[model samples]
Target: MDLLTYIFFAFLFIHIFKHIFNILTQKNHPPSPFAVPIIGHLHLLKPPLHKTLTSLSHHHGPVLHLKLGLRNALVLSSPSAIEEFFNTNDIVFANRPHALAGLHLGYNYTSLPWTPYGHHWRTLKRVTTINIFSSHSLSLSSRIRNEEIKHLVERLNVGFDESRAFKKLDLKSVFLELMFNVMMRFSTGKRFFEVGMDGDEKKRLIDTLTKILVPNTKMGLGDFFPLLTWFKFLKLDQKLIDLHKKRDDFLQSLINKHRNHDPSISTNDTTLMGTLLSLQKSEPEYYTEDILKGIISMMFTAGTDTTALTMEWAMSLLLNHPEVMAKAREEIDSKLQRKNILEESDLANLPYLTCIVNEALRLYPPGPLLVPHASSAECTVGGYRVPKGTIVMGNAWAIHRDPRLWEDPTEFRPERFAAGGEGHLGHGGYKFVPFGVGRRGCPGAGMAVRVAGLGLGALIQGFEWERVGGELVDMSEGSGSPTMSKLRPLEAMYRPRSL
Candidate 1:
């Protein structure tokens, strides 16, 4: 009985000590709101995290640290802080933790976005940058883009009328087709939209992809509270597993079929899968089947909704601001009026068009919070010691709009990035980084900009766009785990050019 009493007393003493230690540590770290001990500030997050975090940054200085449940998150909003990461500690901050969703999606520490910084990551980056995402590959893909754009223009042209006749159309389908077709063509040498898909099949494919790409409230129970994971009745685990199976079945089938065929017999350039498959023969271990799938998945996930959403926002911004729209259209008409189509080469000469795209990205970056970046080693960011494995997210949205940096930051002003105008934040440089900065920044940024420029320039040149019912276009943001999109689907009336 005496021994039992002593044991109870010791347990109570240890618990008290732990609480005191926690209090001390909490005080030393950056100041944050009073949060429930275990849950941290997870409950504070609302639909548009970009806005919320930016507001928080305004209140809590530039570099704000918070306890996100068991995870540690650092939100960097200041340019100096961001530059430090890009210049001084780029490699140290390049690693990323594999989140539960990433695991359930079958990436399992293999995806380029989640892979740790090491040989495997280096190899994958080399393959992605050099072999697949190279300048050559992008140049080659221009033909595919042109073909898809032709279809888009033709589809819209059918709505033309000499009088005040315009068609109110859903652009979601058009953008999805453009993105998905390009992704598949690069991955499987097939186009999901081009050949024999019925209306229902096309809808199903689009629906499935949309469900996966957008963030949902449904994922919270698992992400925040792991104890609930054992209860499979929720079926969250099963849903993710099913998504994995469906994705793999489709991708593997393509890889297998390509493996059987002779590359020499194919007249077209080898797809990304073909190149990776060929490399697999030379380095089987590093280039595993899952790794190949992860790479492709990264491209698809990274490529689709973000690109589509940016175009949607660009058009939305133009619709809301007719003056800006008029200026942009004038530039497009003057530059490419005689030509049958807008070429990628024309992008360099159109500085104002580039500025318009930059402004759009500033307003709505595909991923408001970039793919979670993890610390590979101990480092100090903004005078705080960030231990290894601590998840670091540089709030791109907040950085883009920091009042300290930008003049009239919230307003949509494309001229900010024009040739002579001081770019974002009143700095005479590429101050706004929607694609992110540093080595782990989105590799497809250049391609995304070029595609958006050509696509937007073409639409402006070929058709006259206006809001439906003459109502103001709502610029409200939508909910997503990883990306920020327009809450209301951007619906606009388009009429073909009279000329």
Candidate 2:
């Protein structure tokens, strides 16, 4: 045979051997749909991504795998599968994926949410849990929360006549401002939205914050195709860089202002920043400026919109179901025992109100898909091999709405969470994961529940709410947001209830 024939035969033999080896050694991967070249299954991902993912899961089963461009993803939509992953493989899946947002917006992945699971992450978690969200810290902060709720109620009472006519109010803005103020007070001992405040500064601050928090649903192309990032065709990185600079500058200004103030003489020393600065004095190594700013930013970015969105959603649900609203109000009124205002401490006794908030969280979680987790090492989940570095996401929204999990799952029945109901919030086994589950569950769950409960109970006690124009408040979820916000800003008619 000639040299060409020999070479061809050799190549054929190698190819055959390789194919046989692959067949013998290939790992058992989860089910996946047809993937096209280059883009993989990215085309299947549409706006309101949770819903889109749910549809895919329905067709492919709960433990579905997909190739997202150059990345691999494992999506779990069933309680049993989700329980297996988080419970059995929690450590293996504790790391977060290196998304572009984490790089630019997360202080280069050092922020609490984006940091890898390790000592630094553990330290950050400890600080936040002990200093900010602990029962002791929350108890200390109760006065701040109560004062803010009072301001919110008083603001809502403005311009009301004795007749108590319903007034049209933009509840989205109302809830947002209340939460921002509450968080701001916790962080800096300042309220940005008080009446008679400097309008220009308030507008400027709100504009900056709104721009910073605006959801950019357009995933950067580089995130999927790393090589394309070098070209920078879309300028997503540049935009994020600019926004980060704006955020950093603003936070640094707060630090400097507090630094210049004498905490010994200033009443503002009780703020979260002041406490951190004091800690910095004692433990400079751990409480660096970036750490302080990261905590503050986490509190604002993670805490504010989500808590506010929960309140707005709860209110919208209450408006749509007046019976539920009335029941909640009755619970609050009876619990208060002639006291007109709802306090944070009162929330514990108002189980039905708590149920209402939990139900709202169930129907529309702030994060429909919990923060994505990346596997640190290969692990078995649902008896399928999830390779190392594969991105894992649990579709909490789908699980929450799964008819198999709850009867009349789509209905607005807070009673499902009441005593003798299917389950209570935070107690159900992986079935109720609005705040996620396992090692990486949100540390701020306690604070979030308190804020939501207080705000919802206050509104229910203070207002006789009605749908505007005799039409239902739009309950449609907004697209392109990291949080599940209403597509239409919630508008409703509310008048002070004559207590």
Candidate 2 Cα outliers beyond 4 Å, as residue runs: 1-25, 198-207, 232-236, 262-267, 479-499
Q: Candidate 2 vs. truth: CA RMSD? A: 6.6
Model 2, 302-336: lDDT tens per residue? Answer: 88879988988888888889899888877876778
Total residue pair clashes for candidate 1 = 1
The lDDT of each candidate is 0.70, 0.80
Overall local distance difference test of candidate 1: 0.70
- State the TM-score for model 1: 0.85
Backbone collision count in every prediction? Answer: 1, 0
Q: Report the number of the highest-TM-score candidate.
A: 2
lDDT at position 209, candidate 2? 75
